[model samples]
Target: MNIAITPFFRTLGEVADVQIGPFGSLLHKADYIAGGIPVINPMHIAPDGIAADPEFSISDEKAASLKRYHLEAGEVIMGRRGEMGRCAVVLPEHAGMICGTGSMKIVPSPEKLIPEYLVHILRSPRARRELENAASGVTMLNLNATALKGLQISLPPLEEQRRIAGILDAADALRRRRREALALLDTLPGAIFAEMFGDPRDNPLGYPARKLSDLCSRITVGVVIKPASYYVDDGVPALRSVNVREGGFDLKDLKYFSQQTNDGPLKKSKMKKGDVVIVRTGQPGRAAVVDEEIAGANCIDMLIASPKEDELLPYFLEAFLNSDAGRQMALSNQTGQVQQHLNATALKGIDFITPPIEEQREFTRRLDEIRRAKENLTTHLGELETLFASLQSRAFAGDL
Candidate 1:
């Protein structure tokens, strides 16, 4: 049951002190020193934590002059440029870092607001929308102390706030752990491939090698689907480069095909199980094999190759394409000025040392197990993410 308790709304500035970073002129590029105080910029403030070894730093003397911008533990450091409401708390170890021009810091009043609780509210969906709506700029979005302080938040008793924060933190931890497990599982296939065949570039194992195109029946690309042909409920799955993860396909953001669609750009490009799809743009060169589940799916702007089972299996082909040497070959031959590309000819010319089909198949058996485990974790992670979002929604609405 959802319970909506009336919450006392309070402006952020009423309970916390907001301060923007130092003026840009005060910290110029020439003022940076090798060993000195690290500067925290918008890019350095990640959701995880403050980045170590910040690109620019100031001398001891300079840090003293800009000491007013120094961050403290429990204070929230936020990006003043790009992605409106992104903020991360400063850890104890990062206490003395200087806030760069692109950041702002919020110090909550200990008697009125808990820093952890404040951070949770600031990162919530409601708060993000408010922040984005309140932001202003021309080329890039921006946040100012006035805008940050004017945003209002629903306040609960200190104890209740802590309780809500604790529950959310625990849920977030589980989600993060599942994500880490998925990452580890994702790497196992690459590790096994390396152990079996060695690097495609060096060919240290002396396996018979050939041009990538030589081991394939045909190398082709998907057509660019126009806006009119895109649909969701009543068409074929349209896989784009974004849907292609390094070792797997991400089915989350799929746009579907139309009656005129399967007949258009993707006419003969319909995916088949074991067909290797390599990203031709965006995150270029990343490759994954088409699983049976999406065998008949149509794709767009991706390099597709039907591996010759007689010479090279699909598993080896994917592993090699993602291998360091194979990636280098694809990147070197890429075309296009703004959006880089890996055309069929360029992808075909990639060189790789081919291991025997038996050895490749043997490694693939273990590889498949790891992939299955990762997929399971990914599914669980998705559920946890949904739960986390639901919890955040309820907690802020005074239902938790």
Candidate 2:
């Protein structure tokens, strides 16, 4: 195959019309009306596509006033502020919606570029890097229409563009299916919990009610005094409220504390495998178990619950804390005028009906299987992403 790399690079402005979204000053909160035209903002530009927030919409009357911002099918909507390279192609369903204050519209010239191919090009890592480097802002990066329009692309024949886009679309679809599988697996643990124990709210199983303190050996708060001072380049990992997900941990942006600190002042906050850590403030009931990966980790501003092991299992407690009834119980007991936080006292007092130890073990067994499946699916999804990225690089380099 002959590799063609010459006489193809063209500025985006030559192939597409780039226009900034409406200014914040032009769209006020008061202009938003329920059941109105959807506004596509930076947050709305999700990995799959536009995830519109109903609250951030404008009335048809309000949308009419900003006619220039009206979207047309086949146009690409890109976020102009904060994270760069977030964009989605407007489908027929999205037509007539308004572009939001933090986004911009890119209308590709059909003869020069197809919307599908253009979306892939802009979403590529190289394009994202260019946008990030060119964006300007002191606090948060912002993309200007001029800079966006000036971006260059290795233009290919329409037939070749369609072929590459089709290949990438297929690979992306596989990744999406894997992701959907993982999402479904995530819901399994909750379903099992409901089936085994019934809703904790009603205790339909007629299990005996008990405070969390009665089941746990101890309940306490993690290191809360000047935790920032213990930051180190690399040492014992420290868990924070941000790291706690509903039923797992998000290790991204994890901070480390000196081992000396972990063994000394923060020793009380040290977590062992099977320990449960709950969020203290923002997103108050979210919790996760301390797995072997971060078994000896120390935490900050989290409520640590050590299961008796003989009576209760950490996995079971973690699942319950993430359940609907558990969340409501946490929220109802939360105290604080400014931040509404769940403290050790509040967590210890939260009541739930205790199931038999044998039943608890059975529930944890099912949870383990679901989580293992999720891990395998997650690994496959990552591999598919790497393959898709390679295809994007090659296709744009005129090598595919």
Candidate 3:
């Protein structure tokens, strides 16, 4: 793709006026069921594009106040805090939406800039670096309207801008297709789980139903007394509450514990090859199967699990525990005011149905196949994302 270089590069503020709305304005959180107004927050702008999260909504009163900063179809919205530089172009479908204080709205001067072109530029890595530099705060970072308005941006001719955005848009479409394929890949395991076990709550599979404790030899919470300073680079791999993924441990970035710390509790929490690890806090109901690679690793305070049983397969149990049914059970059992937690006793009481060993093995086999497919799709998507980033980088550097 060939892109013409502009006579002169300029700052975005020089070509377009930045519109700053009122400060400290609050929007009432709206429920998805109520179907009132859609409120845009930093989280709503995903890495790929705008995502429709059910959690985003605004009350009628707050919606009325947002009329002042009402988004137009072609304007761009960017997060100013936490996820700074995350940008999205407002489409007609999102015209009536309101943005929170954490996001800044940008409207380009129509004569000098194309909205789609500006969106592409803002999403580039260069713009992200600028936004990160502008962000300020000790505990939580934030970007002010003034800093955003002063950020530099290169400008091309209007015709060139449209052509460049067109090429990028095509690439973006391919990226979205890969994402949809990945989503479908994820759904396969859930579908297979539902087919094999039926609903655990309804017990339509005609399998034996028992409380989780009845099947396991032992179940316990993880070690908590270890200090943060006790963590080392290569002493012994320690599983923090965050290590457990949906179906297994993600050992990509495991923490290490020092030899000086007491290994007594660590030994007690030491996971076996077939044991199940469930997150007891933070993200509840998240569970994983402990494989041989992490057989001797100890789990942190945020996780708990059960020893492997003869009647049940660890992989099957992990899949079931991470399903929608398991999440509901964990949520109901959770107890806390600010941070919710599930103790070993509560987790033990959760009931699940177990199929025959042959059927369990069959289910696991099918799940493994689906997971392999998903892994392939995920790898392809990652490659595509890298290609997209490279294009964006080159595009902004006047080499597109």
Local distance difference test scores for all models: 0.81, 0.88, 0.74
Off by over 4 Å in 1: 1-7, 202-206, 210-214, 222-240, 250-258, 264-268, 280-284, 292-302, 329-352
Off by over 4 Å in 2: 1-7, 22-32, 51-68, 331-339
* C-alpha lDDT of candidate 1 relative to the true structure: 0.81
Backbone clashes under 3 angstroms, per model:
0, 0, 0
Clashing pairs in 1: none
The residue-by-residue lDDT of candidate 2 on 1-400, one tens digit each, is: 9876343889899999999988868898778877789999999999788888888889888899999999999999999999888888899889999999889999999898988888888888888899999999989999999999999887888888898889989998998999899889988878889889888988898999888899898898998999999999899989888998888888888889998889998899999988999998888888898889979999999999999999889988988888887777866743523336888877888786789999999999898899889989999999999999998877666566
Error of 3 at 165 (Å): 1.3
lDDT of 3 at 250: 68
Weakest lDDT window of 10 consecutive positions for candidate 2: 330-339
Which lDDT tens digits does candidate 1 get at residues 1-400?
9755466878999999999998768888888777689998888876666884644788889999997899999998888888866778888999889988888899988887887777777777877888888888878888889999998877777877898889988988898899889878777777887888777667888988688789898888886546344665777888888888887877887888875767765578888888999898777889999988889887888888999988888887888778766677667743523226778888777676788788988988988788778778888999998898888777666667
Off by over 4 Å in 3: 1-7, 24-68, 94-102, 210-214, 226-230, 250-254, 259-265, 302-310, 326-341, 346-352
- How accurate locally is residue 201 in candidate 3, as Cα lDDT from 0 to 100? 73
The most accurate candidate by TM-score is 2
